[model samples]
Target: MNSIGRAPNDQTADGGLLGLSQRLPPSNAAAEQALLGALLANNKAYERVAEFLIPEHFIDPIHGRIFQAIVRRIEAGQLADAITLRGEFEHSGLLDEVGGTAYLAQLLTAMVGIINAGEYGRAIHDAWIRRQLIDVGETVVNNAFGRDPELDGTKQIEAAEETLFKLATEKGQDGGFVTFERALTDAISVAEKAFHRTGAVSGLTTGLRDLDKKTGGLHPSDLLILAGRPAMGKTALATKIAFGAARSLLVQGRETGTMPRGSVAFFSLEMSAEQLATRLLSEESRVSGERIRRGEIGQKEFDRFVQVSRELQALPLHIDDTPAISLSAMRTRCRRLARTKGLSLVVVDYLQLMRPAVGTKPDNRVLEISMITQGLKAIAKELDVPVLALSQLSRQVESREDKRPQLSDLRESGSIEQDADAVMFVYRDEYYLQQRMPKDTMFDSADKFHVAMEAWQHKMELAHNKAELLLEKQRHGPTGKIDLFFEGEFTRFADLDTVHGV
Candidate 1:
């Protein structure tokens, strides 16, 4: 055994790890100086420097995780230990990837040693962590700006636009001077306006009348969370937006001029893409679609399915029916899509069903959710596209007479409300009232039964296909709601204004 590789002792030169301590960063002041330099020069390079500065101890990846996690936790005003970390990693499904528990202990030992070395140690840690976050934030901001660092804000947008306009309109003429700042602001504004136009359906729109008037579109890089209690039409309303956006190009003239760059990536942790497609098909076919779900469709129904399938095959929508996805995996996939296909929009059919990757147990459900939402915000920024994630309300919502969800109702964790750029909830008063009779009317007890019958016969005749999209939140715009037509047969949502709401 000693013949092949260097003996285990060969890897350690000066008496195992004890020989290596002197080489550790700042072993005193020197280590602090080196770390400060790394943090100042490159914010993201700390992880590398962390390993480089103390390879003897952080040689293992788990140790790095532990070291980073503990330092971050300490910074956040929390205590850390194997018990807490083990629970966190297990809950977050990260234990195996975390390697072993002892590594975390070693990592913490290193953090405490480094952090307590003096105020300088703490300062270095803070600078390093600041750099890490700024690195992350830069990635986020760049994504939000869509590959244009110059697109910093409205001012940058205007500046860039002016530059382009000058180049086009001025041609060879030296059109005075369009300051770089002014041109950059103009360009950014142009990029923003272009992004906004994608979400605006020219034909039939369902966003709140008031809100729509203010925002024009949901805006790109917006992490929109649509949450509600079970059966609250969360999916129904989101689908309305999806269908509305897609059809705007189909029935209307929006997508006619330019070839599509990327359509939509609708990630369904709960529903299958085929199932969503079937719903849409039924809505378009104007035939009872539930029969197909039950596999009781006769020849005529099968014919309708065929027609619907033919129509949907051409839409620029892609669906992934993956269950229990990791945030990192989603980011990788979305980034690839954006790079290759120019992804336009990302939709997650509900968030709670997703799971963190295995190997690391999260300390608490709240932290796990925080990580997920934060990851999603990153993805939204990176892809420079809107991320529409569906969510569920807590059981507390059911306890209240008003089942309509507020930010507090975001199930699993409040971190969702904090992380999302925009939060929306879908509610249907009519759906809620099916259990209670109208107070003004004389109808009693059997009112729901009668209403169900009427919905099936009378309304179903004209439009059993009706739904309401309650826009409960819009971070930068108005908060209200809207109504739409829900076609059960086609699983398609239409502007109720086309039939009734107007």
Candidate 2:
């Protein structure tokens, strides 16, 4: 393995200076032989390790072939004893390559019993994992030594992280079918939690009353799309949800003493971390972010901002404001946060700005968006956290008479609708109506202008401080519009006053 990507030295032909034995990667040859023997001795023993062990897990190539033959025969509804495999190998003219029929008998001698097959298989797999780790280390070293000039220092680090994440999560056999009884147990557990919890929410509560009642809650392993046209307050709503979830997590932790606020990862592609922080502060303090930025706020408002900022200093919300962050890098960062701090939710501020995994480039924008959404869903499932990704609606929404975004308005990508567990649109009728306000200069008469102005004012009054969250496509629940209170000045969203009417 160490000699893999480079030319062999002069001593390589004669077993190398390091010697063939020393150069070999970590492997348990006896364990491999024992596992194969157990499989050949009792075909039922294969089930003990079938979930994790494969043919390549064997140290010896001959053993791999024998294991493969056994698997094929067993899967074909035929007995896979040593004699049957030998006959199959003989007919295939590959008996000699596997040390003829003698090796089969030797493997039987190597086996102590079929009862230990699972243990032996695990040993072999552990050795293979170690070998893979060594290979990854070598690649990292080789790349660090300038093996790939195109990859800069940071890109190399990201690439290494990507490789390690894949290895850690997807390598070997970590997933398989679950028994029906066990699955039922898990389902019952979820139901029990829902019964005990407020509003029957078995998942993370988003802290929005109507939204929680409508959708239950932000569920784990769910990829939710929060999309809208420009000026629709998508970012504001996403931030609100993140803040709510973080607060809920913190309160729960304090009550149970189990955690310190479930961590939230906000990947802000368009805005810097400070900018996002300011937006949150503006929402909390009821001071306009623009006013704060322009130094237009009074001393009282500024003091309120400072106090709110200090109070929010302990929220487990982390922001990664790297623009055009690739999916691999995002996954790596999220994994790091999950490992160190414990992640509960992820928010990507607009997915269109995100790039796919490094080294992958789609030929068209649509495909790229598809890849990004799929990656987001994958991350949601991998991390067992809800991912709230903001997206841009297509320009076609502007041409519509109602101006309320539908599922088709999700930009150019159909995959966003397809991949998302829930697709929500942030639509503010006030935003569109403000654009249609009649100007006196465009009117021919004062009476006409007054009529237009009055009509516009009536519409504005109705839509003022109101935002509709259109839950268009919910895989597990109903779809409808939920009105929320939106303050454009502070860019904040909250539950509407249902008792007083929205």
Candidate 3:
């Protein structure tokens, strides 16, 4: 049998591959041979390319088997020269299929130098990547030709995009260890930036002073879960963060007379883009969005709204109001945004409404939620930006006497709690206390009812215009409650005055 596999369409007078140009995929057989030869000559050469290249990257099947055998022997604390590899292959009944001892000797002739092993391995890996791309293209074409009847055209597009993204990110075997010295250098850089910053905020600031002091701003590659029950200002809080980041980016750009690298991406799965914008306008103009919609604003208020809208037109905040968007679609859009305009933060307003990747039908709701959280975390890491995902709390919080949300109150708590780097709950005691006011009909006497009502009014007064951000889980910092002032009319949150001790 031929050592090089015979090509069916390349039969000629000498049975060579002169006419096999149209039949072969992209491959570098010579480079594979050179890399394997170097490995056989000196096992130390493997360290140069071990982080990026593997045996499957080889073009020839025999070469891949030989590389695997050599790796196995070397990793087992044995010398892996030509003689030892040949013996091991012979014992495993693979020597003859790998062109026997003669082919092994010929590889030594193919050896160029041990120093070039990394280059050769890279060449082989590049060819492998090309081959994979070809395969992906072919699969896309075949699926488009009615191979999968279950997927419609839009879903097929999502599937194709998902497959391409997977190959783009997960194809190469890269990123090994880093030295402790390099890590210390990064830490020192963060410290230096914090020292120079006005408020010592090391990461992206949330624009709330107490929250910034407690959390030190939003760090890159962090998955921060902002969760709460209904009517607890979860959407309002997320919108606040997105607005703050965008405003900061714009202000920094203007002050430095340079382009800013920070921008905000808000994914509003529940609300329309217009509604989100209106909320921001109301917060800035101190006018009620409900009244604006009802045309109850006077001339002065309308002019203020117009002026605030004009000012906010320059903020680099992008909103996507797509309902129930899948994770892959979000990733694709984020990547596109990052490519065209820089991205610093991503906000997904309510994670429960998001679907997993297309064509992934999990067996249960828990697994589906797990996949979605993992995807969100992966997006955070891949883009090297903070992802603030809003989540819903279970109704069990309503039954609790304290009404302060705990970690267990998170809807689909398992994956969400596990995957999040930090978990925060928005709690308003005023909301719960408002429901506890006693009525005249329920009390035995007017005096008793008035006493209960007075007690309830005092409790509401204590909790009014206040909201608590309970940090139940933080991977890198302390966990406690940070008080914030909430305006019910504007649906806005601000740093509470610490001197008065709210």
Tell me the deviation in Å of residue 212 in model 2.
1.6
Candidate 2 lDDT, 341-444, residue by residue in tens? 98899999989999998888799999999999999999999888999999998889878788898887774785899999999998899988888999999999
Residue-level lDDT tens digits of model 3 in 1-502: 4524655555656955444334568788898888888998999998888777777788788998899888887777789988987898889888899999999989988999999999998899899998888777777777889898987788777667656655665565455786788799999999998899989899998988888888889999999999998999999999988888888888899999977776899999999999999999999999998999999999999999999999999989999999999998898888767766788999999899999987789999889988999999998998789999999888888787788888887645559999999999999988888777787999889999989889998888889999999999999899999999999999999989969875
Residue 38: error of model 2 in Å?
A: 16
Give the Å error, residue 464, model 1.
Answer: 8.4
Candidates in order have lDDT scores of 0.58, 0.88, 0.87
Q: How many Å off is the CA of 242 in candidate 2?
A: 1.1
In angstroms, the error of model 3 at 384 is 1.3
Off by over 4 Å in 2: 1-129, 142-156, 166-172, 179-182, 441-445
User: By TM-score, how accurate is candidate 3?
Assistant: 0.73
TM-scores, all candidates, are 0.54, 0.75, 0.73
Per-residue error (Å), model 2, residue 47: 17
All candidates: CA RMSD in angstroms?
19.6, 6.1, 7.0
Steric clash count of candidate 2? 0
Measured with C-alpha atoms, the lDDT of residue 462 in candidate 1 is: 45
- 1-502 in candidate 1: lDDT tens per residue? 3323343234454555322222222223334433333333333434443322331223234444544554554445555456666787888888778765664444333342332333434444444444434444455556466776544565343334333333333332442676788889976775566566545422123333433554465556778887877776667567656765554434433346664545677788888877777766766666666777788877887887797788777665677888887765566567656655566678888778877643347898878777778778876765567888988777897789867677767646848887887777666555555554334244556866677566545533443345555665667657666656554345455556654343
Worst 10 residues of 2 by lDDT: 1-10
